[model samples]
Target: MPHPRRTVMAVTSASLVALATLAATGSPAHAVDDPPSTPVPITTPDGALFSYVVNADTRQHTAAVKRAVRHAGGVVVQAWPQIGVVVAQSTNGDFRSDVLAGADGARVESVGATRTVPVSEGTPGSGGTTAYAEEKASGAGRTFDGSLVGATVADPREGEQWDMAMIKADQAHAVTDGRKGVVVGVLDSGIDVTHPDLAGQVDLDKSVNCSDAGKVDESLAGKTSLSGTHGTHVAGTIAAARNGIGIVGVAPGVTLASVKVVNDDGFIYPEYAVCGFMWAGLEGMDVTNNSYYVDPFEYYCEDQPDQYAAKEAVRRAVAFSTARGVVHAAAAGNSGTDLDTNTTDDTSPDDSTPVTRTINNGCHDIPTELPGVVTVSAIDQAGLLAPFSNRGLEAIDVAAPGRRILSTVIGGGYGLLSGTSMASPHVAGVLALMKSQHPTWSPAQLVAAVRAQADDHACADVTGAPCVGTDADNSYYGEGVVDALGAVS
Candidate 1:
């Protein structure tokens, strides 16, 4: 199951790096003028191969920082000088300290481990490799896979998608399925291009795998999607073709780019996510749907050094994409906890063992929490908020149908799954539709229009949870359920 992704306030802009650099002319990040005490350095156990995100003060500092990384016994897997972020891996437990202690480390801003476990996929550029064995799941009947109860015969399984009708996507389709040129980057595991509904829609040229140490590994595009169906499910919801073969997507006319960010272990690490967003910006994608949290930590705290550095690197990536005219939407989460009042988190450092730790609202789910990104929660078939959907009074931007959604799965088939993960793509599809209708609109304009046009659904307690806020805007359904009909209008 896709871990429920969630939200919080966005990180400050990259310009902050200009404001805060090493205190002394050449210091080892002992103290900064602002931001919580010097970021607590990350600890890598002896002999444990770990991945890291090293941020430089600015792009000008990137070269010096790279030299520092090599001196610290680390391999540079991917370097983004545009944002001054570098992805590296090393077995040396003293990499962080050593990097800061080096002569070339003066420009190094911060370094943090990207994962808790050893580099499972092995260091990139080496003979070391990982395999993605395709897993097939075909549906013969609706036992548990995809049995349609109210599906109309005209579109095969169209009626099974009550989510479309709830968001008024079915009605919006009459206006336009979406523009063919609008591209949505599905930043998840991988999108199955072989599926009948998606075959003609996915642009293979724009698709690339970001799982290989956050580098663009073209060979994995479209071919490795079967290893996990989550990305396929998300792609189906966004733009499954309207060929009358199976279910139609929220925007069947829009093109899709499988910016595979999830690795073989089903985790979306910071480096991979950085690769996905940077790619989206470089490819000029109109929008991207983020269904999974950047793993190792569901909530990366800005107060901690490692978490702060990694989280900032992701923020820079998202900011870069948004600046280049791409909009992002992400799941609010599945834990059902009130994001505004979150306390303890026990599921973090997920690539390894999870240990409960004290947390606060300051620690947040990235991309979703990053400012300028549209944060969304999930609603059920009844048009009510899904209990599993995390809600935040100020965090969530909009709500969309998510419970037991029937979407494309592996084996060129359909399956039913639910989560805020399923909900985000609906909004992503809507964004694509709005983008199609208003081609010259800026990302801010599209986001504002969607939030302003959502239907007002009155708040109602879900299983005694006592909804906070009114129908116009609330913790459960931010700006109420998204109005697809309003987008294309």
Candidate 2:
């Protein structure tokens, strides 16, 4: 049963407010210095990776960064605070730029221009750059740390009234066949390359991993983690490569790419995730899928200010990408309470007592809360909202099949799982279908379409008797369950 007392804040409004303010101001509202206009670069002759530290404090140091890049015979490609600037072709291979560098600041941020993986088969515009796959682990339908089991539907599922079967039954209406040319990007763990169900169907030719700072690997390869399977499952749902076996994705023909950002522990540090978002933007991916989010109950209200700051930064990154035409989809979050109002009671954990709920406002609660991103929740096989699914009446824009969802696992076999995590991919797959049909839609337009054509039927009534009827987007079911048929139409 769904836990009624838990409140997860689907706070997407704050994101938009930040974006609007940014646009109006025409500059960043965060604390920091301006980046160098003509930063230099530094690189090693062997092409092997090297590490360096810099001063992240002042203006003269900023000039020093440029001088360092020039002195090293390399050009500054990228620079970020807490992250070092990447330069190419330095004479001695030593580079410095204080735009944000410090002596003790050994922050291993990535720098340098992202390289595009070469294309093998399809036309450039047809599929664009693709994401590849990497190692797979065992166990399906679980969390990255192997700490929890995702939600699943019961046989004839408790919520059969609203299930993927229904979507498949109505697939014809949901998707259209056309030379629309959409490129869907899966930004998660990594795919199960050996899954028979999603073999050749995947466009391994265009995969990339943006986790180690900003290195983009075309093979969609990544370091293995319990969180890795999340990417694989999302990818399978979106395109799975149409090989003869396994299940067919929502849009089997569209091209797919993976931008692995979330680590094995399911940690999506804002800076890293933002870097991935930036790279995808530069690559021009049509739609990007984000299945992971921070567990909100990890921090306290005192930290809310800092949390909002990080969220603002991420929001900037998402807006930066979407402005370039990439669409990002994220989970609403797993916390069962409003992020703004739900504060911990400050009870000390007893010996046998588990840490049931703690709040951490610092982490980006969910990328869903970021601006220009589509926030999704989950639904069950019977068309009822999953008990564990986070509610965001007005905050979430769509919902999808998240319960007992069966998809590719690392070790090749398939498994079932639940959670808004599982539900998020269904929406990703649907976006792929949309891109396949109408590849030209902008991020905002895609969002608008999903909202305008959503099946508001299953939405939760956050303020009523038994809470069952029409109401604005509430905490229980955001925009109700996502109806692919309704959305695409």
Candidate 3:
């Protein structure tokens, strides 16, 4: 990590110009403006689906609720008044009987009110006891009441989540026939095995909670609220279960393996990050998506043997795994600055004497700055670069949809979220499509495909934008927004 001054000074003239242009012109494409007020139903590449939010907390009498829903011909998906989460479905696309009938005054907010249906074998309540109790008490074994009953429906990538839409649209060419499969390892927090949106897709058998394995107390199950929503969201984006009711992911047919590294505090111990990479490598995963980096305050770049050792370990692991055909993708930190840190002068931007700030604080620097990683930046639905995203000519590899992005959530729900955390999945999802298109593609070949087909444009002058095509290589925007339709072909 270098001081902010040095980080800013590292910006070359060409890179600056590109940044200026990107900011003015926005990203290469346009954001969807007329997306309906209701959430858009989506299908994951795997066939898993998701719907919108339904207010079921108001439903009091359990029997009355069932009868009402049955009268409307709607099937109650799942209910959790404690968290005010309920999902219902209708195969015929009838909104009233499907989501609003049984539960009186139940304001159906999203598209069809998505419900998660777990297809993973073994225990149905493996995610946590909290989730189990909610489902069990909601009449798990009862039959529908009658015409009021609505069959459960799966909706994938609902809402105005245009970012995921683009990614999914790209995969159609590679996986429409379902002849190929790709596994992506999401190294983040833990995943919710019982999430309905993740129905049929969570690889519970291979899932592990490495944060604090033996910390369960007598009063509670061996679980923590911080079980890994981040990982769950990333997994849903990559390959959510493709059954028919919840939101669909870009590569729903692909397999997702969860490997927890970051904790509730979102701080990933370098050692855990390294171990995650190593394990994913051994598992023969096709791609690995890392949406987090060491927090700036916790970054150690100088006089810290332990910190450097951890970084080196991760770097080595990345190299080893990539050599075996795993495409490693990491977010290029959230800080908006020039990421080049190897400075010739330790002085401030004013050319004053060097200070400690010039030597060791993580300024514009990021873990994505490391070599051999496909470091990505963030872009909005309108194809504009996110203002908070970091940039550098030599450090970044590419850009993707990151702002106001939508994906799966805990306890079978969905919402709008922003961050490079969201953007990285766009690339990972595209990579899955690439692998399916060319099952025999090497890691290098995949990278080449993306670079060659990227949109070469700049968005430098308009607030925060990507810098693309200003140079033969990449500056701030890398090769530019990844083109799923172009890259796969």
Candidate 4:
């Protein structure tokens, strides 16, 4: 099964109410000095530490909030004034309570810990094995004695890449292979920058790792520290080089930037996500591909103080990025639950022991459910909805090939994988193509064009319940499979 990815808050009822009111209404006026042009990292005390996002009324309130954080025995780790969200850590287990009770808390909107968000790749064996291992297992290289060789092969496997032709990317390439000016940020584990298919296609200058304290560390860019190949696969699907040596991407001409967010253990935290989005906006990236969900809680509910704070901080970061013209694309998840209907979430608080709870539509998958995000579902080779893909008319904005996808992986090899994770990069690549063709178009305009150009796919009658919605729009197919030719033209 697609294991739920793993990875807290303190506030009084009255203070919570006040913060809720602040969220509803605009912040009160207050002034402080300007924040640094770049994020400044602060060290936290040793011990069991917790991450928190302190929402301020204004940039001027940042100093006061910092002071309050210090007085409360907490340390400021990173400050993002562009969205008025601060990343802080403290050994005090009651950091949230202390901040809310302090004088500076009055100037803040909400303070909650940065929850863990794991990058879910769907069921094991669903996407087959890792590309590197698969190639070696299949004896991709055989010596004269019939023994398997460990040497890498230069197989592009172009004919097997049906997903490319399904979206008509090959035909679209003739019209425009994408522009060099356009860039797509792959916000996932990390990319194999040295791969033959992605060597010159990566923009190292724009790439950075945001896996810690919401600070952008250029030194960590393109480094996968772990053995995971998810980020490399995603990057290949988006902008792998068209060197006629390996698999070609939807927009092979566009540039890609690796925004490493997933840690060595394959977990994605809130701080990393926030930093990735903020950095993308600041760098003027045309589109961002989000292949995972922020974890700890699969659905962040408003009734829960900690979950509410995480949602608010992420929502603000996404809004800030979208406003800057970065089109955000995320996976719809592999839970197979209908997002439009009221369903119970049994995998919440994934960082610890998961508790089965009866959750309704009020609880949402952050980023995917947030406003202005381009949510993508998965489809199989025959234009059928993937069994593992989450479906809902309300949350799904588009559909793309995701099952048994063949793409570049680490070690300059190729392999087959599946999940909504694979599906998201397809849409992100199309967005890049569209951006290249229409450089002056806004994010809203690009989204509208993407949805409008899709080829309609009707739901099929299969096991369980039949598909819902009409041909115009449906819970399974969204606006139908994305069309690359249509996107570029």
Question: Lowest-lDDT window of 10 residues in candidate 2?
Answer: 113-122
Model 1: how far residue 405 lies from native, Å: 0.6
State each candidate's clash count: 7, 70, 69, 6
| Clashing pairs for predicted structure model 4, backbone only | 31-60, 32-60, 116-295, 117-294, 117-295, 127-418
Best model number under lDDT = 1
lDDT (tens digit, per residue) of candidate 4 on 17-115:
545565543221111111111111122333567677787666567777787788888888888888877888777767776787787777676777664
Q: Mind giving the per-residue lDDT tens digits that candidate 2 earns over 1-489?
A: 222112223334544453345434322222122111111122233343332322222322344555554454444434433222332222232332321133322221212211111111112211101111223233332222212111121212113213455455135323452122576777776666556544444455556665453444444335232254667777766664334344445555566666667544344444456567766677777888887652211231212322332344455467767888988777665544443333342221111122444443322244676666788866667666666555544456777777767666666655565667767766766666665556667778777776666566644343321233254354555555565665455
Model 3 global lDDT (CA atoms, 0 to 1): 0.51
lDDT of candidate 2 at residue 85, scale 0 to 100 = 30
Model 4 lDDT on a 0 to 1 scale: 0.73
Error of 2 at 113 (Å): 24
| Model 1 regions more than 4 Å off | 1-42, 121-154, 220-225
**lDDT of all the models against the reference?**
0.78, 0.48, 0.51, 0.73
User: Compared with the true structure, what per-residue lDDT tens digits does model 1 show for residues 172-245?
Assistant: 98888889999999998787777777777888888888887888777753335544778888899999887767
What is candidate 2's CA lDDT for residue 42? 24
lDDT of 3 by residue, 138-178 (tens): 11111212332122333433445577555444345343412
TM-score of each: 0.87, 0.63, 0.60, 0.84
RMSD score of candidate 3 (Å)? 22.9
